[model samples]
Target: MLVFQLLGGDLRGALGPGWEARIADPLLREDIALAAAIDPQQRSLDARSLAARLRGLEPRRAARRQAREQALQARLQAWRRRRELRRRRLGAGLTAVLGVALLATGAMYLKTEQRRQQAETATAQREAMLAFVTGDILGQADPYDSRSSGAAGGGIRAAVDRAAARVDARLHGDPLAAAAVHGMLGNIYFAQDAHDRAITHLEKARTYALASGAGDPAGLVQVETTLCDVHRIGGHLAQAEEACASALEHARRAGPGARHLATLKLGQLRSEQGRHQESRQLLQPLLEQDTLGTDPRLRGELHWALGLSARALGDYVAAREHFGQLLQVAKAMGEDSSWLGWAYNSLGSVLVETGEYERADALLQRAHEVFARTQGEEQIETQMPDAWRAEIRLLRGQWDEASAILQRIRQAWQDRLPPEHAQQQRIAASLAWADAMAGRTEQARAALAAVPRRNDPAQARARSSAWRTLRWSRVALALDELERAGELLDLFEEELAQELPDPHPLRGETRCLRSEWARRRGDAALAVEGAAACRDSLARYYAPGDPRLQHLEATRAAFAAAP
Candidate 1:
């Protein structure tokens, strides 16, 4: 235990350095180490016995102990050198890893900054593009540089083309600019009624707007309204309705009165489709306001719409009342020629339907004169004078003259008007009737076949059934198919009765057809019944002196004489 305590205390005291000094004798360190290893539990060694062994030791054994001590000292030095080398290598490796990590972090931060700057630049460019585009629109300036620069004969088309070109130029290398330009182009195309081109541009604009993240509600509404117009013009009624609905919904979310004009358009669409109740419902509230009511022009427009809707619903009294109100509004507004012409024509039609043919003739003539003054020698379809004159000619039995006038109208309208215009259909129907009366049966058939069919639900609901039955009856009569004509005329009567008012415009005509059919079949009682109904319906719309009523009376008398 004493020897063990001595070795442990001496080793611990010499922990840092000078182990050779602590040994005192050169071979003592090895002897102590060997003794500790061999018999550690033998705490004490005999000093006299160690000396005796040393004295008796062989020369070779003493040399071997010295060699063993030197070898153990060499091993300790080699192990320390290895540990120092390992530490230096580890420090170099750590430095390299930290340097790489720092460099990678700096590079990532730089790349992120570059991306952020690029995105900001792109956003700024988009804002600029929107400003320029919106400015061009609101300015109402000539879009074309040349047109705006005072070029002669600079039409709306020239202006739009110029603006479109400029917008396209600014779009170079700019996706957001491209989107704005597409929307602008769509607007131009829509103005020209180039629906296909408009659709292409609008769709492209929508894509770009979404891509550029410029999805403003107002901007979306503008684009949607244009698309709606295109669809409406194309006779895609359902699509148009959807577009309008979307626009209205968006407009409501945006601002007050934002959709006032859109609502008017919706009302017009409903009127055209024969939804009189809905049309009235939509416009009536709009018209009740002072802003719409007191303004002569707006009032006139409201009354005109109301009259037309009433007319379509076969409410002649209400139609006449509305038309009269429009006439008074026009006079009060000092709207002299074309506007008055329309009001007069509408009034005249109502009067004619109510059997006031003499009064109707005066109003029709007045409308014709007004058109001649305003529109010159050429009569446009929408020009009330032009159509009212044609109507007058037909009512007067000038079949050949009416046909010539309508054919001329058709030629003029071939390029100028949309294919689905209601006036065009009316003109075509009149032409067909004129041809039938003129004994040109095949020509009449062809003309009748040319009447375009409307898929708009409102229009179909309004007149398709009645008109179809009437058309078939005419066709059968033209073919000398008496049995077929009788059946079709009965169908026409029934269909007309379902839709028309008691004093409808077509009541006289329907009765005359039915009377004729019954007389042909030798049904005197039915013939008399139809003739009486015809006279009653005629008296409601025309005065006693009206030429149309007189002619009808003559026809009924002749048929009665046949018995």
Candidate 2:
């Protein structure tokens, strides 16, 4: 019981209470005896002794609890260390991932910005180039219109020069734009009859246009065609032909309208070369198109070309009709006096050929007035009409008046034209004719010798040669050099046959010369027959009161009355 009480708590307190009652249970007594046998000290312990013993054991239990607490604290510290290590590793990996993401994003942004900057730069450059190219076109009046005169501050030539200078300064990198500017300059110079300057710029334009891959093919073709025209006017036929052929090929690629322009240019070139049949064939179909009538510029050009070709072919009716149409177009378009003057001159020249002298004279006078007003009286345009009028005077046997007009034209042309220029040659030829007609044989021969021979066998050259030969034949006959006269007449006839077919008006003049030669040779019957044929031919071609026909009629009468 005492042991049981000590095991429960302090033995003295337990014994005071239900110690005896607890010990009275047989199982309890047996447990207490077993405990006593194992632990005698515990069995012998009283309340005071047990209390002292329990107090002694309290320190060891406290020591063990402290040890367990220390172990638990150490384990918790280890777990915290492991958790902190894992957190640091995770943070470092996240930081690396974030840094890479930021870098990639920054690189992407920079590339995008760089591309945008480049795009903006390209757009700016293109805009600048476009502005440079279109400035002249937008800022000025029409450069090609003769009636506009010019702007308030400057004329077309000055404006074009300023624009071209700007282009050269600002548009060096843009080949296509530069090409367009050069072409514009070329047209301006060509209009002013500065052929050398025109050719220089046009050739440059063509070169740049060909080099620019993205250039407008139609525009390139137009530049080439303009180059062809400048070269043609400058009398570089081979270069003009080459340029025209190239333009034609490019025009075919451009479209039908461009091709049509190229075709017209080629036809004009052919006409200039005196291949009148080919020119007529090439241009006739285009003229017949109903659509072509609506475009006055095109119609006028076609009619002008047709008129020139027809006149060369001795188709006077067709020539007159074409010239009439051209004049109508000029009037309809409200063309300036310069254009009207040229149209009137062309029509009047054809009228002269067709023996409508009165109408021809009226038209020629009107043309002269227009030219005098528009292109100064001393200008080539005015001189041309004056020269034609002088030819009319020559045909009427007003030799002094004809000589006076020829002298004026020759002096003016010599002052203004190059020594070897075609116009100068024409003036020289005309002066020679006048001198021969006035019976100044030596002066006539000297003037003829001064006219240079062109190496080309072109129709213009052939015509000039024929006229020159006829004048030489007349001069030889006046000098009584019969053999030389016969030789010159033969040469004149050959050139006429080459340049004109039978029944041509020019052939009547040749036949008259032949009759005069036969009369000088004392072949009365031959002279009579030749004179009769010459008179009939002249009547068919010349005006009713033409002096050449009157002279032939008198010659026939003198032959018939001869003893």
Candidate 3:
């Protein structure tokens, strides 16, 4: 309003009637007052010039207008810069997230592709294994083939022998399948008691499985378990221990079934190594589990190992029960007669320990016949029952017959057993016992002296150790070396106290020997007491026909009081 009036050249109207009261801006009021005081006469003219300048060329008003516009423009530019910066940052963030997503997708794609390829490869390997097993391993035999000459009947053993040669040719591209086949063949050979062949194939399987990316830890467990067992039976204690430890290490990473088998195998190896107490300790936990798993063969083998451990520890009742369980398992399997025969022999061996000689004889005879008919005499399986029969004769002092049987099987045992093997040591002791009975004292001492002590000190308290010690005592008695005989018998008595129950066959035998020792020392009352104790404790269990039983009866009758 003031500017409009000033442009109209009416300063009084622009400033209003009371100009000082109307103009509120102090700087404007002061400017107007100063203009009026400069020259009142020219105030009107100056006001007119100011009004003209306000209408056209006012420098203060133009400067104020330019400063306000520049401030507003600067504010607008700052807002635009902030918005642009936010957009650029958002674009960069989005780019990074998208790149991360793409990388994740790529990784997922690669993992899926890898699994698919592995599955396909496994399928190919399984298929190739099937073809090789069917065509190369289990095919109908060729009569014209060279295996007909020496492998006897061109049997499964012969087929395996032939297939082993062609494994690299048939499954050369798939070492995993080759490992599987070799493992299978090794187990078969192990079953057949062919340790050399079994070891050859099992070692090859181990090599291939480790190198060929064998995905199944269970396969490694199986190969290692069998290899461990083969070395155990072959009397390679150190190798057996290493293989068993490896089996257990692999088993820890595998499923429960594999772990169970490996653990059981290690327990069995302990039994073979004369760590009977250790074996029982290792195996007892597996039986404590809620379930023993679904494999009948595994259950059967568990019983077998438990029986061995129990028998080694001189728990004859438990051993008999376990062997009975093994028999039931073998019966359930029906067609596995080899296992049936083994079960029979095992039970018979325990029966012998318990003085059930008649029953033991029957079982041993049956097992020997079966093994002789099926597996042949060269097999340790056949030799096992045969050796037991020899032991029975040796117990009865049928030295000639017993010595002949021992000589027959000695070569077979030596062929497979290492020089210092436990079995070899036992057989050598038995041979010395035969020499003792024949009055060849120096020869007996020489033979017994050649036998090395068991590798494990714990075995010094074992059932096998007791049996060896008993033989040494008997040899001393036969030589009339009463002092040596008394010392050895004292050791045998201590071992029997720890290992055998009352009325055990071995205990009864030791008692009879003690009675004879007393008789030789001219102690009639003590001899009568020992003879009566042996006769009373063993009368019901021993076979009526057993020579030891007859001998004990005669000795007791000789010491009886006159009527």
Candidate 1 structure quality by residue, lDDT tens digits, 35-150 = 44445566344555544443443454558768977997898799679857866878865776757766997898799786666555544444444345334432444434433222
| Model 3 regions lying over 4 Å from their true place | 1-125, 134-163, 166-173, 288-290, 411-414, 439-446, 452-464, 481-563
lDDT of 1 at 479: 52
lDDT of each residue in 1-563, candidate 3, tens digit only: 32322212121133322445433333345456656644566565365564454334235545766897799789879967985786687886577675776699789879978776665555544445545554675564553465422264575446657777898787767788888778766776676666787899899889888877647677788889889888888778789899999989888777787888888989988887667778888888887672354655567788888898887655767898989989887766543246677888999888776656678889999888777765666777787886787788886778988888888778887776765666777777787788888877798878755533444475454335666677777776776767666766777786444645454655766787888888877788888888878777666455676677887777667666433
Q: lDDT, candidate 1, residue 210? A: 52
Error of 3 at 487 (Å): 6.5
Of 1 and 2, the candidate ahead on TM-score is 2
Every model's TM-score: 0.58, 0.67, 0.65
Candidate 2 wrongly placed segments (more than 4 Å) = 1-159, 162-166, 335-337, 375-379, 451-468, 475-484, 523-526, 558-563
Instruction: Name the runs in model 1 displaced over 4 angstroms.
Output: 1-156, 165-235, 289-300, 320-385, 416-423, 448-479, 483-499
lDDT of candidate 2 over 304-382, digit per residue (tens): 9999999877888898899888888767544343667878888888876665667887888888888787655656667
Q: Give the Cα lDDT of each candidate.
A: 0.62, 0.68, 0.70
Better of 2 and 3 by TM-score: 2
lDDT at position 311, candidate 2 = 89
Model 3 clash pairs are none
Query: Could you arrange the candidates by lDDT from highest to lowest?
Result: 3, 2, 1
Question: Worst lDDT window (10 residues) for model 2?
Answer: 9-18
Write the number of the candidate with greater lDDT, choosing between 1 and 2: 2
**Global Cα RMSD, each model:** 36.8, 42.4, 36.9
Model 3 lowest lDDT segment of ten: 4-13
